[model samples]
Target: MRCWAIIPIKGKGEGKTRLAGVLSASERDALVDAMLAHVVQAAGQAGSIERVLLVGPSRHGLDGAIPLLGDPGTGLNTALGAALDTASGGALAAIGAEGPDRVVVIAGDLPCVTALDLDLMAQVPAGTLGIAPDRHGTGTNALSLPLPDASRFIFRFGADSRALHQREAERLGLAVETICSAGLEKDVDEPADLTDAAPVFTPAR
Candidate 1:
């Protein structure tokens, strides 16, 4: 099946405010950059994924290698809406040629996510929604679905996202499957999350 990845990134000094006490402004930005790079690389490495969309503030300085979409500079949910639009063409191709039965949405903060996680999520049966909650079981760290329009969910990346997503799916008459994926559940949002995620980027054991 053909797959695509949509990663939404908030500009430095604009995200992960909870970790500010533990990391300097530069440190937090660096961590975000690293996580984004890792996720993009993993998507590129995944055989099933044909495209990766990096959406963020137009001025965000990501190295030239990654394709970036200029967002309208709004809330996280709005940025995500734009990102999904950017991925539409690829989504259409996947559906028509590559079997767009499902597309994976992963946050840029998930440093621990690996190709294996992608493979597992890809297995979600057609017409089903798969979600991996954050450690708090409130936010959704990763979600996969074959819905023709993923934007219908209206993502709001906050404490109640897990419940919200499920609610949205239920309202749409979509079946939801919650998975306990370690890599997908772990996100670098707090200082502890960053510390825990550092090893994933280090040389393999």
Candidate 2:
């Protein structure tokens, strides 16, 4: 199946605000950059993913050829929804394709995410919704939606999002398959989350 990955990322010097108490502003900024780069590399390396699209400002400074879409200066849910609509509605025409068979939406803050983890999510059965919940199994870290089947699925990224996404998949009449892996489950959010991403916070990068 032709799989595409959509990563919703904040612009430069953004995100990781919850860790402000533990990390200095500069430290948080570096960590955010590191994690976004890691996620983008992983998505690009995934053999099952045909393309990797970023939804955010174009100021990430990734030092690579990447396609970026404007964030619309709104919440993540709204940003991601617009990205999906663009990917499925008419943007494919520009790429000389109809649409992807599977669409994988992965958060940009997952420093631990790997190509294999993304591949696992993309390989879910047709008509199945693949969800990778956070380590606590409460929030969602990554998702794989089967084509037009889930093109309009709502994104619930906050509290209980894992369960909320599952319910949304059911409402869309798609089977739910949970992809659990260390790489896909870890996401740094707060001061307590720093330990999980300590290796990824190289400020000199």
Candidate 3:
């Protein structure tokens, strides 16, 4: 199936505020940039992902290889909704080509996410939604949905988002398949999360 990956990134210097106690403004900015790059690379490397698109305030210092959509600035859900619309050919005709069979929505802060994790998520059967919850099993780290049904899917992405998404999927009568993987479950949000992902943030020798 043709799959498209959409990564929603907050504007530069606008994320990881929870880690302010441990990370300076510049440190947080750099962390966000690094995480975005890692996620983009993993998406690009995933064989199932045909296209990788970014939705954010500005592309700015991004790698520039992937296409970028301006964030609607309404909120996370709005940004994700716009990306889904684009993938459905309702917008961004330049990036829409026959539309994608499946759309994967991944958080930009998943530094540990690998191409294999993405490939596994893409394996969800038709008419089913694949979800990868964060370490605490409260927040959602990754989500995959069929293109036709994605437009109507509600994106509940904060505070117990895993349960919210599961309930929403059930309400929509869609099968929910949980994709559990260490890589997909780890996301950099609070200071503890950052510390846990320290190995990834470190530069190679």
Candidate 4:
């Protein structure tokens, strides 16, 4: 199957605002870039994924090679939906390649994400949806969707996103597979969240 990974990032200096009390602006930017680089590497290494696409205000110099889709200045869900629409519209075919059979939307803050974690999501059955929830099992950390089938799937990235995404899948008659793994659970958000990815962060002082 031709699978692709899409990672959406906030503009370079604007992410991880919840940790404002603990991290300097430069520090926060570095952390965001570091974590994003990690997620991108994992996706590139995943055996099932054919290519990686980024959607956001900027690529933040993480990798000049991967293509980026500009964010519509709306919100996360809208930006993601636009990306799916672009892919499903034959952007690949225009380049003499087959369109992606599946697309996985992965949060850029997952510091510990690995290729195996990504492969698990990419391997979900053709008619099923894969969700990797946060450490609290409340937020959605990553989503694996079969293409064309889930072309119009709405992304609910806010509170209770995990359950809500599952419901969204059910609404489309797709089976939901909750893939919980350590690598997929740790997304650095609050100050306390720093513990989940201490190795990637420099000393606050």
* lDDT on C-alpha atoms for all candidate structures: 0.71, 0.86, 0.85, 0.89
- Which is superior by TM-score, 1 or 4? 4
- What tens-digit string does per-residue lDDT give for candidate 3 at 1-205? 8998999988877888998888788888888888888888899999999888988887648777778887888999888877787787777577646688899999888888899999988778999999999898889999999868766888888789999999989988899999999989989877768765665575232
Error of 2 at 198 (Å): 2.7
Question: Candidate 3 at 37: error in angstroms?
Answer: 0.3
Top-lDDT structure, candidate number: 4
| Candidate 1 C-alpha lDDT tens digits along 1-205 | 6677767778767767897787777766666777777877777777767766677774246566566767778777787766565455434443343334466888887887888887677677777888889988889887886647454656666779999888877877788898877788888776667666675443222
Task: Give the backbone clash total of model 1.
Answer: 1
Tell me which of candidates 1 and 4 scores higher on lDDT: 4
Q: Which portions of model 1 miss their true places by more than 4 Å? A: 58-65, 89-101, 149-151, 200-205
Candidate 2 or 4, higher TM-score? 4
TM-scores of the models, in the order given = 0.84, 0.93, 0.94, 0.95
Ranking by lDDT: 4, 2, 3, 1
Better of 2 and 3 by TM-score: 3
lDDT of 2 by residue, 23-54 (tens): 77888888888888899989999999998888
RMSD to the hidden true structure, all candidates: 4.2, 1.9, 2.1, 1.5
Candidate 3 stretches with Cα past 4 Å from truth are 203-205
Pairing residues by index, what is the TM-score of model 4? 0.95
Following a full C-alpha superposition, what root-mean-square deviation does model 3 have from the true structure? Answer: 2.1
| Residue-level error in angstroms, candidate 2, position 163 | 1.3
- Which candidate model has the greater lDDT, 1 or 2? 2
